[model samples]
Target: MSFEASRDKFQAYLTKQGLRVTNQRLAIFDAAFAQKEHFTAEQLLDKARAIDDSVSRATVYRTLPLMTESQILREVDIGSGEKFYLPASGTNSQVAQVVCVDCDKIFEISAPFMEWYGSTVSLKLGLKPITQRLQVSAQCIAQRQTGLCPHRVAK
Candidate 1:
């Protein structure tokens, strides 16, 4: 969705929740939509601060959950133990994630089967799925051969 449409939708959601549309929240929303890739909360805070110094870390933390709850953002776990946020618009509504256990590299895969599966399950359970994410964790062959992966972070 376009920025204006997203803004309007979020505004309606905020209003419905009895939350005021503060400038800090708008700044955070803009920063998040401007991002072309998934981002951690810390990265979101930095981006928001770059846009407006008055956007506090507290605001980012608080607004992020609101955004997620409002369907403006989707929280993803890529096996990093850190929560990442991605826009809920367009292609991001349904996702399949592949995490390399040895390399710690995350790959977002597009699979129509996943979407169908989610829909089928929801129908069977008589539930509606707001968002769907499938995570597949595996060790890559190269990592198996080398006994270590270059991209693996020391945890």
Candidate 2:
């Protein structure tokens, strides 16, 4: 969807959640949607500040959890000692990365592989699957060295 349409949908969703649309929220959301890369809370605040310096760090932190709760953004831990946020655009969702343990390089996959695995487990367990986010970092040298993903190295 176009950015404007997506923004409108987000605003509507927030309204449904009983949140009054504020300039702060829109600026934060706009900064997020404008960038395609994953962003940390500080990074998000930095971007928001670029657009409107009035946006405070605490506000960004506060708004992020709400956004994640609303499913407009998904939180990801890139194994870099910080969590990052990515927009959940339905089919696009949030892209997870496959990191190279040896070189510390990251690779982005089109779709999350874990969602399928989680679904399978949920069916077997007779439980509903709740996938918060998908993150695959190559922090496992053995897996990468063996040419297998860490989550699939044994197989």
Candidate 3:
């Protein structure tokens, strides 16, 4: 989505929620949208702070939940046990990720069949499904052979 459209949608959501569209919130939103990959709240804070030093960690943390609730951001668990945020537009109705336990690399898979199955189940249960995520953990041979995974942080 264009920056202006995202900003307008967020502003409208904030107004509907009876919340003020503070500068800090806008900064956080812009920073998040600028990131092309999934990011943790701390990563978002760093990016936001880089854009505007006035942006605080507290503000970013506070705004993240609001953004998720507003459907502007979606929280993802890539098997790291840490909450990662991604643009909701990037992750539509359903997503599936394979996490390499050794390398901590998350590979997203195209699963239209999964979406269809989920929708069918939701319909059978008489419920509406907003979103669904499936995570599978496995080991990658390359990581085991090299003993180094670029994405994995050394403990």
Q: Which candidate should be chosen as best, given TM-score against the real structure?
A: 3
> lDDT tens string, model 1, 125-149?
9998776778899888867787767
Clashing pairs in 3: none
Residue 113 of model 2, lDDT score: 67
Model 2 CA lDDT for position 85: 78
What's each prediction's TM-score?
0.77, 0.71, 0.84
Error of 2 at 96 (Å): 4.5
- As a whole number from 0 to 100, the lDDT of residue 98 in candidate 3 is 80
State the lDDT of candidate 3 residue by residue for 51-104, as single tens digits.
888998888888998989877887877756788887777444556778788766
Q: By lDDT, who's the top model here?
A: 1
- Give the TM-score (vs. native) of candidate 3: 0.84
lDDT at residue 24 of model 2 (Cα atoms)? 87
Candidate 2 segments exceeding 4 Å error: 79-81, 92-96, 100-106, 111-116, 132-134, 139-155
User: Number of clashing residue pairs in every model?
Assistant: 0, 1, 0
Model 1 TM-score on a 0 to 1 scale: 0.77
Report lDDT per candidate. 0.83, 0.74, 0.81
The TM-score between candidate 2 and the true structure equals 0.71
Clashes in model 1: which pairs?
A: none
Better of 2 and 3 by TM-score: 3
List runs of model 3 lying over 4 Å from the truth: 90-92, 122-130, 153-155
Against the true structure, candidate 1 has what lDDT?
0.83
Per-residue lDDT of model 2, residues 58-130, tens digit only: 8899889877876778776667787777786677643566765554444567776667777888899999886
**Who is ahead in lDDT, 2 or 3?**
3
